[model samples]
Target chain A: MKLLESVGRIVAISRKEIRQLRRDRLTFGMVVAIPIVQLVLFGYAINEDVRHLRAAAVDYANTQNSRLLLADAHASQVIDLVRKASSAEELEEWLRRGEIRVGIVIPADYERRLEDRKRHGRSARPLAQILVDASDPATYGSVAGLLNLPPPERPGIQPPRWRYGSAISGVSNPPPTFEARPFYNPERRSAVHIVPGLVGVILTMTMVLFTSVAIVRERERGSLELLITTPMKPVELMVGKILPYVLIGLIQVGLVLGVGALIFRVPLRATPQDTIVAALVFITASLTLGLLISTIAKTQFQAFQLTFFSFLPQMLLSGFMFPFDAMPRPAQWIAELMPLTHFLRVIRGILLRGARVVEMRHEIWPLAVFALVMLTLAAGRFRKRLD
Target chain B: MSESAEQVIRSQGLTRRFGSLVAVDHVDLEVPKASVYGFLGPNGSGKTTTIRMLCGLLEPSEGKAQVLGLEVPKEAEGLRRRVGYMTQRFSLFEDLSVFENLDFLGEIHSLKASHRRSRIDTLLERYRLADRRKQRAGTLSGGQKQRLALAAAVLHEPELLFLDEPTSAVDPENRRDFWESIFQLADEGTTVLCSTHYMEEAERCHLLAILDHGKLVANGTPQQLMDDVDATVVEIQTEDPRRVREQLAGMTGLLSLAQLGNRLRLLLHREVENPVWQVEEELDIDAGATVQVVRPNLEDVFVVVTRDEVS
Candidate 1:
């Protein structure tokens, strides 16, 4: 009988909150519209695997071998040969002016070396050099690797091979070959990586901002007095006040995830149950944090300031826009304290790595513990008395 | 009502202090059932503070209070369902419609669905809000909002109702209508403890307590308070009442002087000997001027009680 009464009061409060939310058309629109707009805007704009970098080729060889090598580099699609330079100095000027990411130079004796190696077949070596702008790591890293791919196989041309001796003599020589094959996102689509992390960021922004003003608005408007005078307990009021916003948070998640899958073609690799559980835990943590903020704030304006104060730190330290491991040691420790850091890991792990729940224990348990701690603290901070 | 029944609310030296400021001092009250008890005071006189303590919305810094026979601060949760509180401000959910507001209150009070619906309908009709049931409380006029707040407060038919300055925003006509509704509830054996700064409203209550700077200076029936006033009231009608007021301003043994058109009402200290003669002598009586002693009203009692505390 006692439990039923508590349920009844919670339902009553939740019903009132839902009505209030409906009446506030702008807030309701923000919940659904902001996530979709942010998802589409951020998902399509960020690119990690930069391609089609401009290049200047100074081919002093003027030979078919140099032309065929340049054509092979061009066909790889990593660099676009925009201009031909007469000297290495001119190529260096183009690279300095940011006109091109790579520059290739061939000596005038390049064909003589190949022909001599073909004849002597023993001691001759071919020398070809490439100049590259190593400034932007993301842009230069991929382009430089593509520029160094194994020389194309030519008809009547034998590629160099190192001679190996018998094992009994303890002498061995092997050819040097470097190859890189990226997994998970073989194409390196930025949206596939960014969209999963966006689920956490969007949920944190909306859930914390929306729930932070719930109780403080009531207190400012005097409805809190009416609520306290009723048979509603503090815990019941807190739960009921946040339950409607939790549903709104779920709707936001669905909208963002649906848009992510349909528009960005980001895979949903995790099981539905795992995704739902992670989302629930994250949303609960955010809402409880907001409730705690409301209890500390005396007005709606203070609540807003407090929400933004926490929001900025979460956005910077949660590994959504920057890599967590790249930050300094102190910053990484601070990031560890943020629930969004763990939530981002769970979401990205599930969506990108196809991580099962058993494999995501580290992320899931911390998120659950964060939600539990925040809920207990919020309940403790919310007092029944007006004073 | 039986004479041996317990008082609906009883307090002994109930006090609340905020740092160095005392918002509600040692106030002892015994409010019996089925009576309209009015708390009259000026702004910041702790009327709202006392009401909050009674409603279990605040904790007193010192002393004890038993509301509806339950020890406050200890049994406040049990006392919640039995009491209804209407704050000085319009505290209803403004975004909700009239019917929705009342329905929410009924549900929070744990009323069954069938009972909630019927009670809400009756309240809407009684409060003359049936036509505006679909209107948002925020969009309602001041008088309409007050009626809606009252309807929400009484939706559960609580045994005790605390209205803190309930009609401060309404006009006189609406205030009269509101008092009529309050009286109707009292007639149905509900105990009412309301706070107001209006003297006429206090005059209508069965019992009145006057607070000044967190102290309960006076408590009694309106008639008893008037009879027990420590000053005598004298009305003087003259061709120029302002001149009479000016002349009486610096006079000794004078408590307060108020002018109503061409008549001047003076409250003199009780130790004065023949105030009419004293006033006439001081103002230089003329043949056309008339002076006579009259019965004291609640305002005179208020001025006399609070005037000394101000100094």
Candidate 2:
């Protein structure tokens, strides 16, 4: 009988909290409406693929060999032959002005070296260089590797089989070669990589922002006096207060997923049910974190400051905008403690790679543990009466 | 209500200490069933602390207190369901409508749906808040908000109600209506323990416990407390009332002097030989100035009681 009464009180209090949430237009919009808009923006707008890089070719040799090599580079989808510069100066200028990512320079002696090698019974090495702008390290690194590979072997050519045929017309006729193949991100769009993590970032920000402020507002308004006087247990009150935010978090995830599929054309790699369950877990963990923040904060302003402080580290360290592996070791270790790290991994795996629950159990267990510890501490701190 | 029945609230040597300061000292108080007990004190007089202890919100440091026949701190949770408490401020959920606030509290009290609906409707009608039932609590005027808070507190019809200065900010006319409701509740056999700074409101209680500096200096009916002071109050209108006030302060027989508009009311422990004649002979006054002796009120008793406590 006593338990029934306590549960009833908790429910009553939770109902009142839900009413207050609905009444607040700004909080409701931020917690529920903004996530949908963010999901759409992230899913459709961000692209990570780095294909179709513009390149300027300086063919000083003026030979058929240089022309054929240029044609082959143009035939491939990775590089676009934007301009034919007659001098290396023009090529360097284009690279500095950000007009081109890679520049190919064919030396004047390139066709003459091949002809001499054909007559002397020795293989010749070309002197042409692929100059790349190293400012964007990741993109420039891949382009440089593509430029350095050995030429493809001719058809029906056995291993270690080559002939210096005098019929190779004036060093213009070069051997055939194979095309470069790019795996995974064929287009190298940043959106494809970032959208998956954006889902996690958006949900984390919204759930934490609202849950952190709700309890402190009651304390400031003195409504906490009325609530604490009732027979409701601390955990019961916390859970009841958090249920609405969890539901809203799910709604936001669904809205964003819909926009991603319809507007951004991001594929629904996983089933809707799986994606929702993952998002629910993420929100539950984040809500507990919010409660933890409320436990230590004295007012809404203090809560805002603490929340932003925590959020900045998570955003920078979680590799949402930067590569985690490339970050300094100390920074990477710091990111490991933030729940957003696990959440981003889970969301990206499920949304982009279509990971299953068993595959995501590693991420799920940590979140569950974090939620448990935070919720327990928060309940103890936010008892019916102040300690 | 049988005389042999246990008091609704009984405490022996109840004390709550905050660090070195004793907020509620070793004070014992008994609240009879169906009686309106008023705790009268100025600000910081331990009235709020005592009320909090009685309502099971705070634990006493060195005393035993029973609320509604249940030992406090042990049966606090169980007793909470039976006691309704209204804080000094209107602490209702501001975002909810009047009907919703009442219904929510009713639900917490575990009132059945049918019973809750009828109780809310009846409360609205009785409080004359039915027309504004749909208005948000934040939108209500101060008086209406107080009415709503009271309505919500009594929704469960708890056996005991603790109202901590419920009418401090309320207008005089509304205060009268609120006291009428309290009296009506007592008539229905519900125990009430309220605290207030307004002596007139304190005068309405069946019993008054005057606390000073965390101690209960006096406890009795309003008339009995006034009679306990045993002084005569004389209202004097003099041309130089300020001089009279100063001269009156040095008199041993005079208890207190309260300014009333352009005149001063002098309280005397005894009616000396022609005191008004003595005042008129010594102090200058216009011919139209009049002097009259009147009965004492609650404020006079309060002044004497608190003054005795200070000295």
Candidate 3:
């Protein structure tokens, strides 16, 4: 009987919260609209595979061989030759102005090297220099790889022989071709990777931001004092207040994932059960973080600022945009503390890597621990007194 | 111990402090059941703080209180369902409609569905909010919102109700109507404890407690408080009341001077010799002005009790 009364109080608070949420049309719209807009905007904007990068060529060897090499570079689709420079100075000038990312310089004796190689069978290698603006490493790597490819095919000039020996030679064969095939995303579509992580990001952003102000707003408006005068327990109030948002969080995840599947063709590699479990754990962590913030903040504006400040660290250090392995040791350690950092791994593992729950214990455990600890802390701070 | 049964709220040296500031000094109260008790004080005089302590919303720093025969801070959870609180600010969920707010409170009070519906409907009719049941609480007028807050407070029909300046935002007419509703509740055997700075409101209460700087300076029925004030009131009508007020500002044995239009009401210390003659002589009243001894009212009582603290 006592348990029934407790449940009744919780249900009462939840019903009130739901009624308020329904009446607040602006917040209701935000709950549904933000996810769709963010998914579409960020999904198409982030692309990792750099293409159509502009290049300037200083072809002093204006011969057929030099033109052929330039043509091959342009044909690879990685570099677009926007201008032909008369000297190395012009190439450097174009690069400095940011007009082109790659600059190719072929020497005046470029055709002679082929002729000498044809007669002598392997003389000193011809000097064909490629100057790349390695400022943006993401785009520079693709440009450099295409620039290093062998020149276009010729009638008399044979392809360079293997450095060590022929493949048929038993003693020492040539170095094996370094062929790399990406496992899940062979095309390396950034959306395929980013859209999954976005599910966690959007949930964290909205859930934490929305719940962080829930209690603080009541306190500022003086409604919390009325609530405290009732027989409601702190735990009951917290659970009831967050339960409606939990459903909202689930609906948000569904909308994002649905759009991700329909528009980006993002594959859901894990089963439905694993996905649900992962989403629940992540949602709990985010909501608990919001509750903790609300308990610490004295007003709604403070809650907003705290949510924004905490949100930036999650986005930057959670490996959502940058590679975690590339971060410094201290930064990586800080990243380990964020729930988003662990949730990103769980979500990405489940959606892109087809990882099961058992295999994702490392990521899932940290999120569970975060949810538990933050929830306890939030409840501890939520006093019944106005002070 | 038998007298404790007649008192719905009993306290001995109940106090609360915020750091170095004592918000509520040691106050002993015995509020009998079925009576309207008023807490009268200016802003920051600890009236709200004292009400909060009795409602179990705050813990006392130095002393303890027993509300509804239960020890506070430990039995506060149990006492909550038995008492209703209405804050100075309209604390109902502004986004919710009138009906929704009452329904929510009814549910929190753990009323059965059938009983909750009936009680809500009755309250809506009683508070004259049936027509505005669908309107959002935030958009309602000050009077309408006050009624809604009162209805929500009494939805569960608690044994005791604590109203913290509940009518502060309403106009005079609305405050009158709100008091009528409170009186109706009191007549139905519910004990009420409300705080207000309005003198007329305190005068209507069966008992009043005057607080100043976190201390209870006076407590009694309205007539008892007026008769207990150690001062005499004199009203002087002159062409220039402000001039009269200026002349009487520093007069010996003068407690307070309030100018109401063309009349200056003066409270004088009881030791004064012939208070009316003293005021007339100090203000240089001639044939144009009149000085007469008047009956003591709640304002005179308030002035007499809180005057020393202000100085």
Ranked by lDDT from best down, the candidates are 1, 3, 2
Error of 1 at A165 (Å): 18
lDDT of 1 by residue, A1-387 (tens): 889989998999999999999989999899888898888777754324545667778988877777877887788767778899999888865554444557877778877765554444434444466665443334445664663454443554544343212221231222111123233455556787778878898998888888889889999999998989999888888889899988998888888888888998887877888888888889999998899898899999999999989888888888677655345669878988899998987777667656666566777788778888888888888889988
DockQ of each: 0.74, 0.44, 0.64
Q: Which ten contiguous residues of candidate 3 chain B have the minimum total lDDT?
A: B279-288
Tell me the interface RMSD of model 1, in angstroms: 0.8
**RMSD to truth, every model:** 11.3, 10.7, 11.3
Tens-place lDDT per residue, model 1, B223-295, is 9999999999999888887777777788898888888888888899899998888878887645367889999
Model 2 lDDT at residue A318: 86
Sort every candidate by DockQ, greatest first.
1, 3, 2
What C-alpha lDDT, on a 0 to 100 scale, does residue B87 get in candidate 2? 88
- After best superposition, candidate 1 residue A212: deviation in angstroms? 1.3
What docking class should model 2 receive? acceptable
Candidate 2 TM-score, true structure as reference: 0.78
* Residue B304 miss distance in model 2 (angstroms): 2.0
Query: What is the TM-score of each predicted model, taking all chains together?
Result: 0.82, 0.78, 0.82
Chain A vs. true chain A, TM-score per model, equals: 0.68, 0.66, 0.69
